[model samples]
Target: MKSTLLSLLRTGEGEFVSGEKISDQLGCSRTAVWKHIDALRKEGYTVEAAPKKGYRLAGEPDTLSVHQLKSRLPEPSFVKDILHYPSIHSTQETAHLLASEQAEEGTIVLADEQTKGKGRLGRQWHSPPETGIWMSLILRPDIEVRSAPQLTLLTAVAVVRGIKESLGLDPEIKWPNDILFNGRKAAGILTEMQAEPDRVHAIIVGLGLNVNQDYFPDELADIATSLRLEKGEKVSRTDVLEAILKEWDWLYRMFLKEGFSSVKPLWEAHALTMGKEITARTPRETLKGVAVGIDDAGVLLLRTKDGKLHHIYSADIEV
Candidate 1:
């Protein structure tokens, strides 16, 4: 009810809203309406109240509140709560803290901006407030530890599908965790897990999608892009976020039921590196070969010139 009233107040171009109109629209008493307005005030909203005018929402902080995300969630997810911060060191770090405290699966931690966002191979991801979606999901999956790498691939599929469905644009997965649009990077996912060698514990899937950024940092000008830059229009971060959660939930359920063997074909078709000649650099050395599809264990298969197959666990690839 409070969120509804605030949304209504935002639509009005006046300095104040009549208390009677707010109470009538929300089907609450005037006192109750005032209480809601006070709560919004406490949450960093500047709402002014007057006898002639009901309540005027003058300002709102850029926090990802439960009421805000709940109104945006797709019908499929039961997003119990959202832990939001105006700025955080990292969503993954906060997610680890929540998981240690036994936060429920599907509980999301989102930040308007991340001070220390991460990517695969310990690279830093560029995240700015109101410019990208920087979020982490705390998940507890019933799967073997060895099967974990598959989750990264699975999430890539979800991100790609989400962007396509929500923005009506085609995006492809670049190997393990990169989402590419028009040969440039649009999004990246970082999956960090805490578990025993053989058992599973918690998986914090962190994703950062460049949504409305028009300019990239000089260092990232060659490789990064936002949906707005690519599509020539600003995209709704909330809509894309909901689509990603919905797609991930569906794919995750299927993965738990049948494992990676079932999703291998789809991943292969969506993979941008498949059947292309590429250079993959691992920690020890670099290899150039034809990029074949991944095996059941999610290891990259590189077909060498000597007609031999080499398995790569993690690497930065160039096509």
Candidate 2:
């Protein structure tokens, strides 16, 4: 009921609704409806209550509420709980802390804005509120520590597939964890886990997708493009987020039941730089090579000019 009210309030233009009408429609008393409206007003909603016209939704604050998100989700059952923040340092950071306390799987921590979001190799992920989708999913996968890296590749495929299905945009995946549209970055994935040498622990996958941002900074103008920019229309963040979770659940189940053999072929087929010439850079050294298919371990298989195939565990790659 709260989510419905919020959604209707955000419809941008609506006439004032009378208390009797709301009470009859919602099966509640007029006083009860007034209480609900008051609660919303306290939460930064500007609701106008006139003598005859009971209540009018004037303004709604920018907040990612669980009620609103779940209302938009096709399958909200898969999402156990949603922790929404108006502003946070990072959703991944909060999720990790929650995991330490044995938070349930499918627990999602989403932030409208991440002040200090991180990408691979501790790189700063540029997350501006209402410009992109910045969120994290906590999963307690039944897999060994060695198999955790494969989750990143699996998530990459899921994200690309979801984008294609939802927006009709043919996005491509860069090896490991990047979704590129029109040769520019559209989304990124960061996978973190807590495990011993052999056993497994919880894995928190952080996703940052450029959704509605129309323009990029001069430095990233040529390398970063959002879904809205590419499609020339604003995309609903809620719709995209729901699609990603649904697709991720599918891929994740496959990986658990069938292993990497199931998703490897699909990922390779959608790889953007698989057959292209590229340079893979590691902290130790950089290797120039032609991109080949990824191994079962989700390592990037780079065949250098010297005819030696190197499995890159972690690093930045340039195509």
Candidate 3:
């Protein structure tokens, strides 16, 4: 309802939209229209109401909103739609359910906080309220199951470019998923799939980015960080998200048309793990080696101490 009301008001940009017209269009009472307008004001939007002229948008805040996000994108946006939640268990969880029910491709699930945020390898992602970008993008790509991990690399590049553009920060990709500044974690990508043996249904990519966190809990103090922590000031979450979405839209089209060949160099340029000796902890064994590079299929190629190259499909990388 909020989104619908926003759309109506936005159609008459730079002018007032009458309360009677809003109620008629929304199929609600005049009182309801005023209440919704008031709600928008409380969310930091400056909505000016007049006696007979009705209401108009006076200002917009540096916050997240479905209406604002949609306005930022191009018409017939590559993003099919974005489902926004102020707070939820996990955007990835909701994305999985939506994708399973045959949601359209390019749909995004966005949230301000996640009570039970998810991470890779059954880990819990810490998602504090209003301080991060917590969102999941659902993709139904025409690619084989073996090529899924490439999307993770693709997303990492998008995020790196996004942060660099938005905050003037040089963030690097810690192979497979994490984005880090210096050595502390700034963001992570968790990719989940609904697929068959040889086919694919949906790829839900969840990104948790620490945007304006002033401090971390004791456990995360040493290992975690945020853009604000690094920049000595606050940053807008919506600005970063908008930049990422634009980058993702461009890269996704290129990926679908060309393939990983185009994305390899971009990922490698921002990759922090490449050419470094690292320890990898997989489910079966622990291996120590120098991180070489990822293959065409997005598999990490590690050259161990004994001079043998190993194909690592899944692991926790310690650099």
Candidate 4:
């Protein structure tokens, strides 16, 4: 009911909607409308209330909520169910639990801040309050466990396309699942899966994007940056999230129909490590070589100095 009232105020277009009219439209008492308006004001929304004119929405807060995201999204089916939080230990953990309970494929777990966010190889991800995008997507793909790694590559393609479409900035994919901008880490993707020996149960793709953050910690100051820092202004998290979901829906559908071959070209076109001398670091050892390309199953290919080609299934690439 509060969400509906808020939506009505926003759609009022800067003109005051009379309290009687709002009550009539919402089928609620005038006092109930006043209470919701007060709540919106406390949530950082600049709602102006005039006794005779009623309430008008002057401004909105830079917060991510289910209602806010749904209002902005063009396609409703992409977000069947969204679990939003002001703070959480990890969206990934919550998403895994929801998936285990048979949540729909397009359900999302999103948060304003993550207390224990993580990236690939168990590295900590910095997710401050109300600054970046920290969310997890639950997907139940009908693919083999062997083909699950390709979903990471698919997510990278969707994120890059989303950033391009929303901000008009071209970011590069760093090997498996990192997005780089101007040689700095702008976003990270971590893909986790639950599978049997041959079939996949669910794949949770977690994305931590630096959207409107203005600063980072001393440790990340040298290597990390945000979209606001790159764009010279604050970018909308809602727009970025909407764009990514739309792109992911389209790309995932194409991948399901035509296989990974259909999406490989786009991933390679924006790949940053291709044709560059780099170091691939796995848990066992590190190898220095030139990145050639990805194979049919989305494994990276590297050519060593000794003219040997190595098919890297999992590693962190340093270019």
Q: For candidate 4, write residues 1-319 as lDDT tens digits.
A: 7778888887799999889988998898999888888888898899998989998998887877578777766664556788999999999999999999999898899999999998878788999989989999999889988898899999999999999999998999998988999889999998999878888889999999999888889999989988889889888898888888878888898999899999999999999999999999977889999999999899999999999999999998899
TM-score of each: 0.80, 0.80, 0.82, 0.83
What range of 10 consecutive residues in model 2 has the weakest lDDT sum? 5-14
Ranked by TM-score, the better of candidates 2 and 4 is: 4
Cα lDDT tens digits for candidate 3, 40-87 = 989877888998889898766556767877888776667989888989
User: Which window of ten consecutive residues has the lowest lDDT sum in model 1?
Assistant: 60-69
Which regions of candidate 4 deviate over 4 angstroms? 1-42, 45-60, 71-78
Estimate the lDDT of model 1. 0.84
Model 2, 168-241: lDDT tens per residue?
Answer: 88899988788998679999999999778786779999999999888888877888999999889878777777
Per-residue lDDT of 196 in model 1: 90
**Top lDDT: which candidate number?**
3
Winner on lDDT (2 vs 4) = 4
Give the TM-score (vs. native) of candidate 3.
Answer: 0.82
Q: Local distance difference test, per candidate?
A: 0.84, 0.84, 0.90, 0.89
- In candidate 3, position 236 carries an lDDT of 82
